[model samples]
Target: MKINSFLLILLFILMSSVTSSSQAKEKAKHVIFIGLDGWGAYSVPKADMPVVKQMMADGCYTLKKRTALPSSSAINWASMFMGAGPELHGYTQWGSRTPELPSRVVNEHGIFPTIFQLLRDARPEAEIGCLYEWDGIKYLVDTLALNHHALSPDYTEKPEVLCRMAESYIKEKKPTLLAVCFDNPDHVGHGAGHDTPAYYAKLKELDTYIGRIVSAVEEAGMLKQTIFIITSDHGGINKGHGGITMQEMETPFIIFGKNIKSGGEFSESMMQYDVASTIASIFGLKQPQVWIGRPMKQVFK
Candidate 1:
């Protein structure tokens, strides 16, 4: 009886070790796409964005990514969502003219497939969510596809509220993909130039939200396999975008997560369209043949 008990104990130890190791190898189960509407690419290294820097410590980063032509918020966000530019996605109008929220978008026109539509069609059971601050979101995606869609006030004064809702939902739902759109930086950037002190301060505040969301992911035990793609639709030029100037068009892409090349900078060219394409490719979702955007191969480990 003593010998039998010893053998059983050894078997249990072996099984426990094997299970722990298996969990360690498990990849991230979801993708967290943190899209900062007007997040300036230049700040990735220049500004004191601790959260962005911490992510860079384990991800492939680039400071020179580009947004689509017309460099406006509405048009580029469409490109970021559908992996196509304005000419292809058909979003000509965007952003606020005065300080009010923009009108709802109509997708009744013949629009190309978006990440949301493809995900719903391909993985119907998989849950997805988005917390945004802008009304242009109506034009950026197919509303029916999102299982949890939350928005802040239309005045762009509620990023903290948006983040809190997203963080709580992520902890509870653990969706396959969650895009948290923080607009306060863009709001601050437009009023005060991109290089101004206030702009950096807003970025620091944004970093806190990023940290909270990451912590929430960690608590959910999905941090290891969760892929984080941090990017922006456009930067700022003086107080506005929608121009050909590099400041308005230039943006950044910091992709940090499981299966991604960690602790390195990618020299490969990247852009807003690539952002959508990468999300599709990361999850083995084959891009449609007609899609022009291609995933950045260098992002993979």
Candidate 2:
């Protein structure tokens, strides 16, 4: 345990030093990570996703990004949140139950601290918010303590409400971080078939909400200082996942912000853990020593 803490401290110091020297220009004040659950890589064609296309055109993106193994929500999301694979985070099952963590580890006594836990620990006064349609993510060990959070059975009908709340929070509290998850596409994909019209329609509908919220951010004049990181936990089969098929493994990763470089190569491979690392990089947070992935520097200015 002593070794773990020492390593983390050393890593934090080194990363902070680099960040201060190399990444000090145009540091972001807010970061919004939008996870479109089960969003397939091929499903985001320009014809169907105008808003997404606009965002991609304004940022760098990869439609070939791969998620973690097993393709399960609990596993992939856990990996994304804690920047650890299933072997480290110990959450390989489904359902809304707290994760089983190691008996001992670093970071405020939490074995594998989620970004939410780390942010709250580091900055208690800084506001943070999250809205998720997948309830399973609500139970990650120390995730229950975020400044603002909301979960629904699914994102079918009432997701707009979550968006409204997120917009309100952005305008009212100006949270340091606001994460939102849309689960309706995955829900409809499972029942109707990932390639079916219903699934595509659901994604399009969700895209409209995305445009609305982003417009809210723009209207609030936060976009110039805010970073937008978008991706998915995993893709799905016609309506199911948890398999290793290409459809179930591939997802799209996008990064857009004033400081981020635009129209860059989108061919670099990325993993689910890189999502959190990239966000950490944007906010100048020291990438945790336990996280194996690094920021996609190709996306930064």
Worst 10 residues of 2 by lDDT: 96-105
Q: Candidate 2 lDDT (Cα, whole model)?
A: 0.76
Question: What's the lDDT for residue 170 in model 2?
Answer: 80
Best by lDDT: 1
| Tens-digit lDDT track of model 2 for 1-301 | 9999999999999999988886584368888888888888878773277887778988899988787877868778777877777767677665526455452244564546677776676678878888787776676535554777877543455657767866787888777888887776778777888878888887888888788878878877787888887788888887798898988898888878868788744777788877777777776677667777667877877
Candidate 2 regions with alpha-carbon error over 4 angstroms:
1-26, 100-106, 109-111, 152-155
For all predicted structures, in order, the TM-scores are: 0.84, 0.86
Q: What TM-score quantifies how close candidate 1 is to the native fold?
A: 0.84
Q: Report the error of model 2 at residue 89, Å.
A: 0.9
Model 2: residue 64 alpha-carbon error in angstroms? 1.9
- Candidate 2 clash pair list: 190-239, 194-238
